[model samples]
Target chain A: MMIISTSYHIFVKEFVSEFRTRYALNALLMFVVTTLSIILFSIGQESPSIDVLSGTLWIVIFFSAMSGLSRTFVAEEERGTSLTLRLLVNASSVYIGKLVYNFALILVLSVIIAVSYVLFITEFTVKTFEIFWLTILLGSAGLASASTILAAIIAKANTKGTLFPVLAFPILLPLLLTCINATKLATEGAFLVEAVKEFQILISFTVVMIATSFLVFDFVWKD
Target chain B: MKTWLKIAVSVWLTGIIIAGIAFPMVKVPQTWYEFPFIPGLEEKARNIIFHVPISWATVVAFAMSMIYGIIYLRKKDIDYDLRSVSSASLGLLLCILATVTGAIWAKFNWGSFWNWDPRQTSIFILLLIYGAYFVLRSAIDEEERRATLSSVYSIIAGVTVPFFIFVMPRIMSGLHPGSLGDEQGKGPVLEFKMAPNMLMVFFASLIGFTVLYFWMYSLKVRQMRIERHVQQITETH
Candidate 1:
């Protein structure tokens, strides 16, 4: 109970500071717009298949995540606040807080991408809103859970920018596969029951990732 | 380190080498209609003798790496860290060997050097995950910090091994042979489709490769410990 409030306070603190600085926000939005525009221009005037659109959507989310989520711990280390954080809060609290921040940040990014996909790609459509939304939301959480500890790990390294995505790609591959498949199903008008298998896989992947992160984040966070 | 165990491992390796080659050739006539294997793989299935063992060795190496990584974190001993990285490095080597051998086999059977088969994709992802571990190791300069961070990263990466190697492939259709509905139309893998002699060779290969993995792992761990000692002496001077 006490841990929950402490983590919530950390999240609130992160949210306030983020709105003030807006570095991650700016980075995420710029990445999304630039990548989406390039994709829009390069593939101009061709009606991409639902599969292609689904794949492209995930590519955009993945790269945007690379841009924004890597900053979660790098910001602390750069500001020299990591020591202060270590002193002030428990490792789990810090991890939960950053994880919540990342989850919210990516959720917003995913929503923006979904909306932008709808607007930019005229033929792009989701036949099942629940599956589409569910994939995006759960996928965002899974991505956050996987990347948060990695961000902490990379934050201490020298070539952080290159390290984050290289490390993240393999760990996130299964999640990405399921999410892309689920998205494909939704776009192809599959019902929730029809796509339930993917949903279950994604849920399990998220659960495993989150649980593993919690188990080990203390070591990564403290070190 | 026991002398008899060492002798046993060496003899096992020798036996595997001879049997892996000779048994496949002599166990049954290569041209017999009585033989049971995927028809095309009848001869080239010999690759399975080396290929399956190496892949299984890779998995064993990885599991050991993760186990040692957990120990290093708990004990915070540098030797544990050394064991962890050495096992991972060996795992990466064995993984590459499996990929190459599997690819060579694929070229003969699948008619292409590189098909985007489910099994192939999973192994490729495994390559990336372990590849990133080495990258992570080299990117850090402080010895203790590097050990701690890499251990944590390896643990995180280890969680995905089952997904990439097993669960993900099972969910998708692919060219790789599996228990049911394998792309090659080979039914369940463990059924009577396996000849008695083939089963014996398979068990021998599994045991032989496991012993071989442990031999390589211990050798690397000892080498790393000596290097660390040398560094410490130099620092004292």
Candidate 2:
């Protein structure tokens, strides 16, 4: 109960600080826009298939995450506020707080990207709103859960900027594959029942990632 | 490692290699030594004795690395960190060997060096995971911080190995044997086929390579320990 309250406070702190600067938000949004434009320009007037568009949508989300999500811990370390954070809350609370914050950030970013992707990319149409939305939700959860601990790990390293995606890509590949497939199914007018395997895998992946992050965050946090 | 174990591994691996290569595929097994000729696999099947064991050893090595990572986090012992890194490096080496050998086998069987098979894709991702692990270790100059962070990363990566190597491949339809909808009945290459003699050699090769990994792991840990001691002494001076 105490842990929950402490983590909630930390989450509030992250939310306030984030909105005040809007640093990660701007970075994430700009990244999505820029990548979408580049993709748009390269394709010229040709409309790619839904398969390519679904895969492209997740690619944008994945790279946008790679660009922005590491800021959660890296910023704390950069400002030397990590020491103050350590003094304030326990390690697990800090982890949970950062995880929630990152999840919320990624969720917002993904929804915006999805909206823009649908608006700009006329070729991309969602036949099944249910599957598309569920994929985004689970993908965000999985991304946040996996990246939060990795953000902590890389924050303590020498080269913070380049290390986040390197460490994240392989760990997140399974999730990406499932998300892309589910998104494809969504675009193809598949029913919810058709994507049951993808959903199960997504749920299990998020659960395992979050549970393991909690288990090991102590070692990464205190040190 | 014990001297007898070392000697045994050397002899065992060599014997398995010789048998795996020299053992002839025949229509029917006249004796215990003859291997039954599998219809599709034929001669290329011998690659399993060498290739499959390396991949198995890779999995074992990653599991050991994760185990030691957990121990290091609990005990704060640098030795366990050393053990963890050493095992991971060996795992990386074995993983590459598996990929290369699998590619060679694929060239003959699948008509290309790269099939994007589920098994191939999983191994490639695994390689990326551990490759990033080493990059993470190198980026941290402080000894304890490096150890702790890398250990944590290893644990995270290790937990996903099952999802990648085992679960993903089985769920996705692919060229690999035992994949979803595989007409081979989804039991993997080991279960549905293999004559008795071939199975014996395969199991022997598996045990041999596993023991070989432990031997290599111990040697690596000792080497790293000596290097650490040397660095500490020089720093003090």
What's the TM-score, to 2 decimals, of chain B in model 1? 0.88
| Global lDDT of each candidate | 0.84, 0.89
Put down candidate 2 lDDT per residue, B101-141, tens digits, no spaces: 99999999889999688889888988998999999999999
* Per-residue lDDT of model 1, residues A47-95, tens digit only: 8788888999999999899889998889889989999989999988888
What is the Cα-based lDDT of residue A143 in candidate 1? 93
Docking class of 1: medium
Worst 10 residues of 1 chain A by lDDT: A197-206
lDDT of 2 at A191: 96
Flag clash pairs in model 2.
none
Highest lDDT scorer: 2
Chain B alone vs. reference chain B, TM-score for every model:
0.88, 0.94
- Look at candidate 1 and give me any clashing residue pairs: none
Interface RMSD, candidate 2?
1.6
